[model samples]
Each structure stands twice: as structure tokens, then as C-alpha cells.
Target: MASDLSPASRRRMQLALLLTPVSLFFAVFFLGPLAIMIATSFLAPGLYGGVEWVFYPHNYGRILGFADPAFEDFDPVYISIFLRSLKIAAFTVIATLLVCYPAAFCIARLSERSKNFCLFLITLPFFASLIVRLFIWVLILRQTGIVNEMLLATGVIDRPLELIYTDGAIVLGMVYIFIPFMFMPVYASVEKLDWTLVRASLDLGAGPIRTFLRIILPLTSPGIAGGAIIVFIPALGNFVVPAVLGGAKVMMLGNLIEQQFLSARNWPFGSALAMMVMSVMLVMLFVYVIATGRRGADVTN
Candidate 1:
């Protein structure tokens, strides 16, 4: 005996019902996997190579504790690997920012049709397989590769420089792979910006440097944050670049965790290390949000 609802009300109900699928999808795909990973971190390693019900906090402790014959000391080797990963990630972020910022600015300034075309070009590499891209770098940066040959021909170097199988090569490979991530966010932000604000800054007696520092950079800060987080987090966890370009010599936390689980047969320990990385990423993302808020407020003010 209820009265029928209006069309708008029915539409609202339909939309609400539609959102249930999205919510369930997230729960199944994202939250469920994350829960499994956390549960695995607490479980003890099984004899046959799986999770055991024996819960031990020592797995986490052993990661931070000193390496000792008696299992009493912290492992410096793991600490060193973590530090090296941080260093490489930092370098990759810096290099990506330097290369992408100008390119993004240029793309942002282009006409809409041109902008889309340029973006497509940037994304073309993604269509190719990642392994293929890495292999291309191997060919380009090999000892007797085109780069070394060109340098030798130009007399820039007397001998072929060790371009491959080094930390530098790994960083270069990472930067190449990640540059698009850095570019896209910045370009989006830049494209949305009000050009009038920049003109106003210049109209006020602000020089180019002052305008950029005070106006443009602050307005585009969100993009920088997004791009940096995107680049840094993956670079921190990457195993492929170091393995292929670095010849397994420059081991990162990802490499160590991989070795622990696959080669060393220490699932519990690897899970602990992975949990630490995830925890650090969570903390960093929280801090980034706070910093973004402050910067946004400054820009609006």
C-alpha cells in the first residue's frame, strides 16, 4: 500500500545499489589480499614450505635485531640493503623529477589536441612489455653498446665505460621506466592551473624566479607529491631493475626478501621484512597527506 517514489528517488536508489558491487570488489581484491599478507607475517614457517599456526613475534624482531651466532644481534647486512634501496629510490625520484617537470610543463602548455598526442607518445612505452623495455636498455647500455661506441668515437672516453651491470645503469633503467609516472600527474595538475594567476604574478613586479617559487611551484605541488610517491614506492620495492641492470650485486630489500622466501626458504622472515616495508609506506603516505594539506593551504592563502 506504499506510494511510488519519484524518478529522481528511484535513480538515487539505483545508484546506491550499483555502488555495492564496487564495495564488494574492493573488499575481495584489495582488503582480502592485504589481510592475508598480514596474517602470513605472524604465522611460523612450515616444514614443507607454507604457513604454520605457531605465532611468533620473533620473526619481526629478527629483522631489526643484530646478526649473531647466538641469534642475539641485529643483522647489518639487511640494514645495509635497506639503506642502499633507499639511496637508489631517492636518486630515481630526483632524476625523474628533473626530467619530467620540464616535459610535463611543455605538454601542459600545448594545445589540447597536441597535449593528448604528446601524452599518447609518453604512454607508448607502456604498451610494450616491461621485460622487453628492460632488454632494450641492456642492448643500449652494454659494454660495447651504441652509447659506449658513440662516446669512444667522439673521443669523450678512451675506452668503453662500464655502463652495464652497475648501480648507475640500474638507476638509469628505473628512471626510464618510471618517468611517465612522474610526468602524468604533474601534467594533469599543470593543465588544470589558472594561467591568470601566473600572469598576475608577473604583472606584480615579481621576476620569473619569484613567480615560479611563489606561485607556479606551489600550485603544482600536488602533482609533484603524487609523482614522487608513485616513483619512490615502486622503486623502493623493485627487484627487476637491480637484478637485470645491476647484475645482482646491488641488492635491495626486495631482492633480499625475494632471496629469503625463494632461495633461503625463510617465508616467515621474508613476510616480516615485507610487513616492515608496507608499514613504512603507510607512515610515509600519512605524512605526505599532511604535508599536502599544508602546501595546499599555503597556495590558496
Candidate 2:
């Protein structure tokens, strides 16, 4: 049948066959749930849990302030959660970058076998359950956990200090999980780095700091930006880490959204919060694309 058809016709058929399953998968799995969530965002919450068919714009209005007087007043706590989540995510990105950037450089300079071994070590966490990995930190950070126990044994402190359920703990956990995500991109950039330019800058009477700023940093920036974006996006919406590390004392947007859906039984409100998170992600992606395009143009020029 393919032999009888024109080349263009056969190509079109092949493309159709290749795209059909992907299209169906996205439609059924991705777009399907997205459409349902968007619709649910606009619907009213029922007296008994679940959604009411009536269209209600207050779902969003609740977040932005100006919620319907009959239901509830707009609370600024949601806004605070949004800001806190953003801060934590940003910190996670910065911390992950700091840890991965220099490590990438070191790994890039290693022998092939050493590089592979280092990569295996970096990716070892992924083999285990995420919850299990997080619990290890919980044990290490808790009052009677490893750190405090070691300190107490050495008489470093009179009592165990609070290590877990704080913003720092959350950021630490995020950095641990996201190390691989940040490392791979940075390593790719570092591996491809034009080291000749670095040597030239150093030879031209430039200081190490100046050479890094003018040559090395700019060369490796794409990987840094990419790593930051990937790390930030998931860190922003991460609930599990915050739940296990932050506890009730520290609430992030992810935890807030979870509470609305599970504890409060307000799906519409939860969907609204989710939409807000998605909006922030889209905005960041747009900014990243624009920045990347401009950088590309500058490089070409």
C-alpha cells in the first residue's frame, strides 16, 4: 500500500499514525484533566462537598480579594502563602545551583569512568522512593534525630535545637531532591565549555573573578537558567517536602491548595489556587523564553 502511494501521501500517513497515539494520550490524560480542572474552577462549591453546576467567579475573586459577602471575606493569608512558596522555590533554585555549578565543573574535568561514577552517585536518590528519601532527612533533622544526638554526645549544645519544620529545612530537602535536575543541564554546559576562551582571558592580565564574569559565567549561564527554571517550577508546587519538613507551622501554596481540597472540601477554591500556581508557571516560562531568544540573538550578532 505504501509503495503504491505518492511519497508525500505516504509521509502524511506515517505522520498521522505517529501522532495519533500521542494526540490521544495528551487529550485523554493531560488536556482532559486540565479542562475538567478549569471548568471546576468556575463552578460553585456545594453545601455537601463536590461541585455545584452554577458558575461562580468568586473562586478566583477569593484569592484576589472581593469574594462574595455571603460566602466569606477575602483573606490575605492566601497571598502570603503564594509569596512564601515563591520565596522557598527561589531559595531552592539558588541553593541547588550553588551546589551543582562547581560540582558540574569538577565532574566535567574528570575521566570518563569517574564522570560516570559521579553521575551515578548524583542519580542514586531517584532509585529509591521519594518519601523514603525525605524520611531520612526527617530523622536527621528531628529533635532526637542524628544531628542533635551527635551534638549532645559531643556536648556542643545543652539541648537539641529545632532543625525540622522550618523554611530552611524545606529548602534543604528541595535542594537534595532537585540536585540531579540542576546538575545534568549545568554539566552539559560545563562539558561543552570553551576552555580556550577562559585561558585567553587569564593570559590577557584578567583576574580570576573578571575572567569568570566575562567568559566562564556567561558561557555556562544557559545551563544555570535551565536548571533554575526546572528546579523552581516543581519546588514551587511541592507539597510532600513541605508537609514532611514544614509541618503546620510553615504553610506554602502547595499545602494551602491541598488543605482547600482535602480539609475544607472546597474543590472550586482549590482549583482556583491551582490555576494561580499554573499562571505563575506560565509567566515564568514566557519570561525564560523571551530571555533565551534575546540571548540567542545577541550571540548571533
Candidate 3:
């Protein structure tokens, strides 16, 4: 009496129902702003701050070192900033991975109560405002800051080191802030790990390092990749950390975009810069997806 739908039809109906809210949410929130931003990138900047409805590519050209208004000389300043941002972002990903991997393993190996406490401590910093946390680093890194004071007391140096407003400071801040992001995904993967595989490898002829390189790393790679993407995407476009710790000396793509919009009143150029960042992020995510997919295929085979 109640046999109106096949299994496939029922599954399709359930999926559609489940996806309706998420689809609508993305359409309104994510896609809506993204479409607006992409459209704005091609438009002209208004006389002052806003955008005008006219197509222009000069904004992008300016960023790429063309569209110079004086002497027709090639200006590599913006290009340098973009590349510097990429380098810093890559460094942050590597540093965060190095720091988080061991910490994640320790957390994974802990008792449930200890694991929760460790996780809580790791994430407790998030409760504070990011700006506040960055400012604390600023205090710690400034020439006359705690680090310099301690060194001076120990007679380690005659003068304070130039820590703030430097590339190193920016990288340090980025690594510290993004470590939690990197740790969480790796921890999730480690929590699901089959320890029996690890034991079997060790019971056989495999050393710890060899077993980890061949077995453990491959199994947990998806989480590592996911965490790296999470940390890197944000670090690539980070503004506040650089702006605060860098003293505006170190600049990233986000800082450049923020400058155009806020200082230069160049909305079109800012939009273009934002679009470029999004493009890079998309490319990285695409590569990650393909690699992960290939790994999954290999596993199945």
C-alpha cells in the first residue's frame, strides 16, 4: 500500500531536502557577495571612494606593475609585496605543520580527559580578540619589550634586537596564530588512526621513522592537507597580524587590498586584488582535491 518510490528515488528526495537549506544559504551569503566582488573588479572606481559602472582593466594592470603614471618605468613594488606574501604564507604553513604534528600526536595518544584539556588549552586563545592577542605579541617583540629585557638581564646582548615591524615578526605571529587551526584537523585524523597497523609495522622490520614515513603519514595526509589549506589560505590574505606586528613594514595581499579601499579610495583595484587572492586559493584547493582524490582511488584499488 505504501510502495510509491524506489530506493534511488527515495534517496534523491532525501538528499534534495537535506541540501535545500544549505544551497539557499550559500546562494544568499557566499555566492551573492562573491558575484558582487567579481563584478566590481571589472568596473571603474568612482571619483572618490565607491565604484562606477564602467569596465576597466587598469586596476589589475596597476597591481601587475603596469599602468604607471610616471616615466613609464616598471614598478615591481606591488609584485614584490604579492610574492613576499606568498613566501610568508608558505613559511607559515610549514612552521605550523612542524609544530602541530607532534603536538597533535601527543594529544591523540593522551587519555580522554587529558586530551580534552589539551585541546581546550590549545583553543583558549581564540576566546580573546585577535587584535588583542597580536598586541600582546607586539609587547613581547618590541625593542624594549620583555624579550629584550630578559636578554639584557642575562647579558646576552648589548642592545635590543629589531624584532617588531619585520618579516620575522610577521611570520612568527602568523605561525603562532594559525597553529591551532593546523592542529585540529591533524588531531581529528590521528584520533581515527588504526594503531594496529602501526604496531604491525613496528612488529615487522620497520623502524619508527620508516613506519611513520610509509604508513602513518599516508593515512593522515588528508587531515594534514586540509589543515595546511586552512592555515595557508588565511595567512596568505592576513592583514591585521602584518599590519600590527609589521608596523606596516611587512605587507601582504590583504594589506594591499585594504590600503586601496581604505586609504587610496580605489575600490575597483581593491576588488581586483581580492579576486586575485581568491583565484590563488581556488587553485591550491583544486590541487589538494585532485591529490586527495587520487590517494583515495589508490586506496580503493
Write down the TM-score of every candidate: 0.83, 0.92, 0.86
List the pairs of residues colliding in candidate 2: none
The C-alpha lDDT values of all candidates are: 0.85, 0.92, 0.89
Model 3 C-alpha lDDT versus the unseen true structure: 0.89
- Model 2 lDDT tens row, 59-138: 88888666887967767777778888999999999999999999899999999999999999998886778898899999
The runs of at least 3 residues in candidate 1 whose Cα sits more than 4 Å from the true structure, single-residue gaps closed, are 1-33, 46-52, 67-72, 153-156, 293-301
- For candidate 3, the TM-score is 0.86
> Looking at candidate 1, what is the lDDT of residue 81?
78
- Over 1-301, each residue of candidate 3 has an lDDT whose tens digit, in order, gives 1368888888888899899999999999999988998998888888878988988877777778885365345777878888999999999999889998988888898998999999999998767688888888999999989999999899999899998999889989988888789989988998888999999999998999999999999889899999999999999999998889888567789899999988998888899999889998999999999999999899899
Q: List the residue pairs that clash in candidate 3.
A: none
Between prediction 2 and prediction 3, the one with superior TM-score is: 2
Candidate 1 overall Cα lDDT vs. reference? 0.85
lDDT of 3 at 101: 90
Q: Which candidate number has the best TM-score? A: 2
